[model samples]
Target chain A: MTVSIKLARTVKDLLQMAQTEYFDAGHRTCQGCESAMVLRWVAKAAGPNTIVIGATGCMYVANTTYYTTAWALPWIHTQLSGTGSAVVGTAAALKALMEKGKLPNEKINVIGICGDLGCADAGGLSEVSNALTHTKYNFLILMYDNESSANTDIQETTMTPYGALTTFSQVVSR
Target chain B: MEVVGTGTDAVAYALMLADIDVTSAYPIRPYGGVMQTVARLIADGYLKAEYIVAAHEHDQFEIVKHASAVGARTFVGSSGVGWLLAIEAIVAISTDRYPVVALIGNRALDDPPGAYGVEHNDALMVRDVGWLLVWVDTAQEALDTTLIAYRVAEDPRVMLPVGISMDGAFLTHSEHVFKIPPKSKVQKFLPPYDLGNRKLHPSNVISVAPQVNEDWVTEIRKQMDEAMKNARKVIEEAYRDFAKIFGRDYGNPFVEPYMVEDADVVMVGMGTVSKPIKEAVRRLRAKGERVGFLRIRWFRPFPTDDIIRYLSGVKVVAVVDRDYSFGSPFDGGAVFTEIRSALYEAEHRPLMMNFIGGLGGREITYNDAINMFNMALDAARKGRVEQRVIWYGVRE
Candidate 1:
């Protein structure tokens, strides 16, 4: 599941990437929020032949709601810690179907989007580790490490670094 | 082909006949045998699919859910805590409308002190959810019901997941001879699963199960409600085609009745407990007593129409529940509670009582069935039910 990290090897790739907006406009994110911007680019870079499984996080909440979505590509929601499990499932399904002649044998990008609380902390790592063991499956797990739990109104998560200010930690002593 | 196999083997054969494209599995007793058999089939060239050995149950269930979303026929199974461990994914699969077929080797939910025997509670946990639930009495029924399950679940009228519950030890471990219809017959009965515009594919470009606020939630749930309602008809249609294709039909798709036509008292239940009750029905008939058995196959649609038609005329309907729900209204089992609710719409309104037994997999014998019949018959003769529920075999 390695895509060229450098999308702009030439002026044509950059111009081509700029011309297509796979991640559409009209999201609910705060005007200054960088997480949504990252999501937009991720969805765009993954392109139209991709299925994006957005884990429950600030990015997922701010970018997409029922009937309205910033993603022009096919998207599904997964649980916060479910990004790993979902990516494997989606990738495995694509491979299985393509091999079985149920679906066209095309290289579809399978990307799972998650946040810090979903990926590094909680049981997300175990799920990711399990998913990573399936080396044959083609998928990418894109982890967005936001310092606090944005979905629950900025509650302090295990990913919260030392002396970080959050709704849960107004007076940070350590 | 005719062969003797356990309940798990029956489901494995169905998976092969269905030609499932993806299966994710984890090792949990009773239910584990099917996945093992599937792996062997994959190795021996009997079946070819992505056989993933998942890290745990959550991954196991989730993998199949996503696979089914992309229009791949899928299968998965677990028992006891293994099923519960994947509860989060279980709820999502039905709500997301993925027709992923699963098997539940009905085991007593954990802390059984190493007792991994049969109980209905494991599957009953999802009774209120949108999943279609069915209990099979034998390996033959297990094989047939599984194929029917796929047909019903994948039907455009009812695109919901189906859980085929087979009693642990009694069915999962024991072997029985059953017919395995050729792939051609199965193909005639079950069409290839298609999601059309609803599938999550690049060609079909649709977002599924997005985050929603209060506004759109109710309508989405109402859709599921209608789908569940549609399942009753779809299930009936599937069984009708099943009989036509295979030349074997269990008269009613909802409930299997044995000697209940002219019975005064009918003992009702599900799963392997029906075996003992059926034996008791024969013995009671020999003694000139009008006692019979009604084995409920489908538990989710609750079989209200069948309940009204069958038990409404009987003098007493004694429900032999192998699982219990403590602190419930009347302290009855899940089946007892549901049947009581269904009978409320009945015209005759037969007297009903619940017999809570076989909890934690204690065997309910033919003698126990006779004891239940005697008590129910007594209540019928007196035209009153003194106790709403009785713990039939408990020491206390």
Candidate 2:
């Protein structure tokens, strides 16, 4: 094979070897940013036994757009700020099942993600409070900073830079 | 394959490349793009991990922190007030010493005057919240910063969560040349996340953020403070490594200064606002104005020394903010009151002025920046603090 072709084949083989099951094709959305990249990498890096609790946002809309999804492993979509609570519930269930010897011997992993505006600006306080106050689950939180409400057009957010023009600032003049 | 895109996708791609294992999200203006991209990756068979649709921003953190404790790398985002909603969690994650990385889209806070676009107020409000905060001037930085955030947060010396801020649209929607680094390179930078068996196990149970005496609290706080101080070096080191492998470097990793030497006046701001202000400064310099600019790359931990050193020689300093302090004796001025306070004992403290502008997606023009410079010069000459804070570009 040509060098380029050989490289592509090697990548494919490595991907296959990793045996990541959470990421699959068909989920809609842009690929230029880190949101998709995180999901892609996470699904690949995570082991075979894993469960996902998806919260409301572009991830939910795109992945579950047609009900048919690319999530190879078990996944569920919960309330906007409830991903944490759901994961807790899932972890509790997993522990119960494991203790009952009903769960397989595979090592299981659980995870969560949210936008900065969602977790830092919206109902993030209570959810995070619960996480700190309780120690039922262990996971990583990834804050994707796109700096805009993409579902909406270009608008300023808490993370917006001072003196940078945006739609809301346009209305008021000095 | 080629496809339509946004900066959010770029950030998602960067995290995926970093090997994040868990994901959570919520919908809000300006940041919905991040979630959209995560959803797409799951469909493309590029990742294998759990994607959770959080009930709200709070739950998002809860899930991510839980997962992190159990040794899963997680991700999330939000915009404007949505970010404010998550502020409490932002502090909690840092205090818990969880290695969560949050990407914050800067926007205005709701109050007397309302807006929907870029502002530094929200991020500034939490400057002392014990998180390692990095603000990116471009989409590429957004991607690179996320990678660095993880490495920095995971450092045993700095196990505090990180906040990576990007301006709305300026970095999120703007296109830029980006190279998807090799997986092996990423592996070299970030090792497999080891949770140290902190999760719930029958043999051992430990409390996270358990109630403790003042001494314990003081010690924990001291450790966090030291970690932040140490992070300055860690950030510089990570950027050096990134430059070696990725061919990009953010100088100093704390602040970026432009043409400040021999400058009589210096303009200070962060994120995309700094870009235009820099251009405006060039214009003023052409007209014989000895003006300079400072872009704050790291907001949290405030980089007080850097600010003092850069402003020491300047005759006048102008601080432009998009968010207001509201009800402060400063008359609802920009959030730089703290910066002014830090300069109290400086030997050559220049005349300082604060201006609130470009809030709620409003545009801050080159002319507006020029006007701010003139105002600063006028204040410096008077040798008296004249209305320490001025609302630039405000309408009656």
Candidate 3:
């Protein structure tokens, strides 16, 4: 029911614990992919009690590139606008099982990972906001602010920084 | 207990009797009554459940999906664009196989000249998304179908969501006397909500609705298709159980026939519109026109085999569709298209035609039903329809 992002100090310490990284190696993320790094850290810290849900974004494309999955724990990938809905569904199912005493003494955390495009551009803003507002089935949405639609080759998204050159956002002279 | 209330109220009563663990609601006209009733029940301590007024319809759907996935017997509802707005969640819940029951106060999607009226477009929009659909014609059926919907959706053989669609204003607002089974009987009938092995839990520690390669995706889809096909039997069983307890049976869970035994022309349709068609058929039969009416209660997992069996002796068939499927190669509505497809292989397929009427809650009166029957009679006698598809009740 709690989501906290703690900075794992130093490359030495991160690499020392890399052997236990829940998001295992061998994915197609670009070199310097901030979203990928965030995913690894979040997956590692959240541990096996967590179920991660990813919207149609860079993480979904790169991490789950078919024939492989980087997540050592349960992971669900849904349509761009379905991150909140998917997490809610997973969380609800888990909670219902727990309440019915069917899954005694078991609790599963539901986490949603979505890129900036998913939050603002992929028609998920309202859905995410709604899930958060109605917190009956507690879940968290990690809106990775990568500024661009990195999955679509770094195309400009609404969250893209001004003057940054993306495939769709070039420095234009009036 | 018998109560005189609208269809929405009946649904709320059923939700309470089913012991819904969680439900979220946002107001949509024609469906708002359901949420209001639920909230009141919660406040008065008549219902012990989680009830939240959601930010919007999309949020409500997400809440319902999650709550259900988490092992909560959840209920949610909306109408028209309200339901359409939640299509994202609807499709996800279905694919993920969450046994969430959605009560749709059936309304038309915003046509150019929009109005708050009944139409099947909202439910039909995601008809292929792998959910069990049951359309009710009365407040009584609304209550009964909803109770059955929960059992059917949560059935291990099914494990798919169910949509209880009632016409907006017409069914949603219309008051009728219906019996509400005692909670003890309901408890015995529905049992406790359990996903069994299908639920999400740390003990299981397995992914749900995960990403898959081409080799696995096809299989997953096929698995879902198999589950939907299996729903027909489970749906029928649930109805039989309901009837045994409630003492009111709607003939069959999938489709019900009305005076078709000796008729040569059969008029087919669904939902509240079919109510008047029954009367029309009665009047036509009295005049020796030899007509009958068949109402389809379950639209999804369409009972093609049962329909063919029922229409075995019929000479002419007419499908009255309140929802249009635009650009169909047959240039007909969904029900018509499905009926035609089912009859294609029949050795003695009757002269069949489609009649589109009652869109946006336009009243399809006995007169309209009579006209449709007469047209079917003409087609039966002539062995061909004057027009393959007729837009009944439309000006021009």
Candidate 4:
């Protein structure tokens, strides 16, 4: 009897090994934030078969500047707080495409990334409620916890810690 | 990779390293930085997934959950009021059995006009929704937990969502030294998202939330309950595997005990508050006070056996909660409610008292935690039940 262990480099390695071309660049924000890195990596990892639903945030304004773009794969900039419905629409579209024998059998991964304030504070409940009710699509929800309204100079969110002062705290306290 | 960064960025990096396929974003206060960072990843070519900017948080969740149902690893986050607003989605994500990872910023609930800082109420309010909740005190923990969360949430036995809560300013904004593990190591730990072909085929249509009778509902709930019960072991296993690859270990899903082995009184807390409480406990121990600290690590599927075992010999227990459960006879302490229920006995129970502090982002300093412990000791000495709930660091 022969024992064999076949090891394909883990998903992480495959992602890193895959070469990424800058489809979106020259954005001014945190240089090494996870949101920026994860999107770039996923674009390459999921190959050209992926579709992105871009909501209103730093990602949309900063990365997708004018006609010059950051996404090499199919992408859409949906309304703020309505990416959930948009992604569902895209999933439905993809499923329809597959049914029409238009798309190949390669798996398509749909992803949703929102900030803490967006998901936990606003618009997250309804989107999540709808997703729960309908379960045909495949998606990923990546939440970022920066602990401030970074675009607006560190305003406090519901996630802020006690005693840590924020822009709103001073205003509300005063 | 070694510069000062927010936990939100670290979370994105972790997802990228874990090979997440889909991404979505909606911006709100305190948590907007995370989306900003993910946007940068798109620009820098570090992350290559679909980056969707939804109209709002609800849309972001729908995108992620729908993707997850078809076996895509998903991520999302919110803070304070954002979290409260996302509460409905939290329940939906869990009930649907999607492996979504949320990075929630802890903030106080509105009402009584609290500060814009960290509080546990945001996550506590949604604990009953069946998401696996863990609080990280630092950026590194935030990143590590995000990776571990996916592994735990995606396990067949625990196909549930996970919430990795962190303090807004403390861990989310603070910079720290962290190692970006080699891609090979990360890949070895997290496998690609693979839902069987049968479930995802176009012809094989199945309803996710079918209208069912009580028995079907009970069975679903039971499965969810069992999945949570099994998550403890899955979390532990994932931690062990992560440590082996990344050289960091997130302890078991039980309260972190500090000097409790030989102490007469113990103070318990969760999230960022635990960091200072640990230091305060050390100071008390150095000063010849037999005091200890128990940091609650896992919030949901409350560690009943571990809490009972750890506090069984202690003479007194002081449970500090950042959120209050209003209108309760116990004066609205959430941690107290859970701890008391776990320790409820017909004969003997530890003299458990509750202290609510750090509401609406108010700080719980070393002095505040120590004073709470002292008050608990005083109550223990008298052998009389003190007020069931006390507020710490509040002025009359």
Q: TM-score: which candidate is best? A: 1
Model number 2 iRMSD:
14.4
| Candidate 2 reference-contact recovery | 0.09
All candidates: DockQ? 0.76, 0.05, 0.41, 0.06
Residue lDDT tens for model 3, A106-138: 545678889888877766786676666546776
Error of 3 at B343 (Å): 1.5
Can you write out model 2's per-residue Cα lDDT over B51-123, one digit (the tens) per residue?
A: 6666666666666765565456777777777777766556667776788888777766776433557776666
The local lDDT score (0 to 100) that residue A98 gets in candidate 1 is 88
lDDT of 2 at A61: 57
| Docking quality class, candidate 1 | medium
Models 1 onward score TM values of: 0.97, 0.69, 0.90, 0.70
DockQ, structure candidate 2: 0.05
- Candidate 2 regions exceeding 4 Å error are A1-174, B1-5, B111-115, B197-205, B213-215, B332-335, B380-385
The TM-score, computed over Cα atoms with residue i paired to residue i, of candidate 1 is 0.97
> Model 2: what TM-score?
0.69
**For residues A15-43, could you state the per-residue lDDT of candidate 4 as single tens digits?**
54454543446444477866778777655
Better of 2 and 3 by lDDT: 3
Q: What would the DockQ be for model 4?
A: 0.06
Comparing 1 and 3 by DockQ, which wins? 1
What's the residue-level lDDT of A73 in candidate 1? 87
Worst 10 residues of 2 chain B by lDDT: B201-210
For model 4 chain B, give the 10-residue run with minimal summed lDDT. Answer: B198-207
